[model samples]
Target: MHRQFADLRARFLARKYRTERGHEFACYGFSRRLGTMVRAIDVVFEKLPPELDTIPDRDTVVDATLMIQAFVLNAFGCLDNLAWIWVCEKPVLNARGKELGPLEVGLGPKRRDVRASFSKEFVAYLEKRQDWVDKHLKGFRDSLAHRIPLYIPPYIVSPRLSKSTTSSKKPVEMPSESLTWGSTTSCRPSSADWASGGLG
Candidate 1:
């Protein structure tokens, strides 16, 4: 991954490319990173139990949840960086009629400038998904990045008792435990959405 990123940076910085080529480079980078995130999410889900209730082990549940969250955060980070690149790839006219590139624009303007720099179709798509993004993805990312305390409920454990051969023997019943992460909800974007919007 590091080597891939190094190659991308080298390509992006190559002097032979014109302005349009720069945008293509940014789009290529976004597609590659998005593919990485999708593969990661797939792997994480594959390790998870078929059903949440089937996870009898507490440690396994905790580890799985953490791993999922980590991947989610990474995916969001990739989107945010792509947005920055999309907005900053070209020069924009300033209030004083001066042309400003990414260095002059900085990160502060990227968020607001994205809507203008990005395509109308993409902007509309973002508007449609604004609520989901804000409530689920952005909120979760902010919480993790800021080191905010997450309310992880105690893991619910259900124990299965072995069958006894003796007529007098009885199996012990174990109480089931459940874990909740407060009222927080998560949003998982589909590959189509990523391809359409992130790639666009």
Candidate 2:
């Protein structure tokens, strides 16, 4: 994985330094393509079933891993599609000034200034968009991929369910007669003791 990343970085940097004469970075290189696949694999592995206590044996682990890998692949493909949408979606700028040409041809100091402004706004927009996407996808992924049936603790469980489990169990009761009251019954109530006045 490290080697693949190194190769990808090298390829990307090579393209970065190359003269863009409309042919430098035309095709996706072998390393870059494999890097994408590796990314998908990583996502899948990360979502593997966490609660393996219920798993019967070693064979089940292997089977679950394969299933998780498939779900991860599907998730990766969805994310890739989203990335493609972002890349392909151009900002619709309605400008009254002189129209600029393509990026390679028209990019200069002034163009760069415009790009910087656009980049700041575009980055914020993309981040917000991705956040919205994540909000929607997290629940779906939790159910379809990362979800594991967790046991409810007895203490944290509802009273009815707990009562049903232990039918013979009895709840502790307090005696009202044990509570202390005033020796004299005919005394004026204090103003401070107006709210929830307990027996003296």
TM-score of each: 0.52, 0.23
For model 1, the superposed segments whose C-alpha errors exceed 4 Å read 1-32, 52-59, 96-110, 147-154, 157-200
Cα-lDDT of candidate 2: 0.37
Model 2 per-residue lDDT at 121: 67
The TM-score leader among the candidates is 1
Candidate 2, which segments miss by more than 4 Å at Cα?
1-55, 88-122, 125-200
Question: Of the candidates shown, which would achieve the greatest lDDT relative to the real structure?
Answer: 1
Residue pairs in collision within model 2: none
Tens digits of per-residue lDDT, candidate 2, 1-200, equal 76866775565445532223212222243334445556646654454434322323445445444554444334434443323322223322225433323331111122332334346666566456554433333333433333432111211334554466577566644343322211221222333432210100
Please report how far candidate 1 places residue 79 from its true position, in Å: 2.2
Q: Candidate 2: minimum summed lDDT over ten consecutive residues — where?
A: 191-200
What C-alpha lDDT values do all the predictions have? 0.50, 0.37
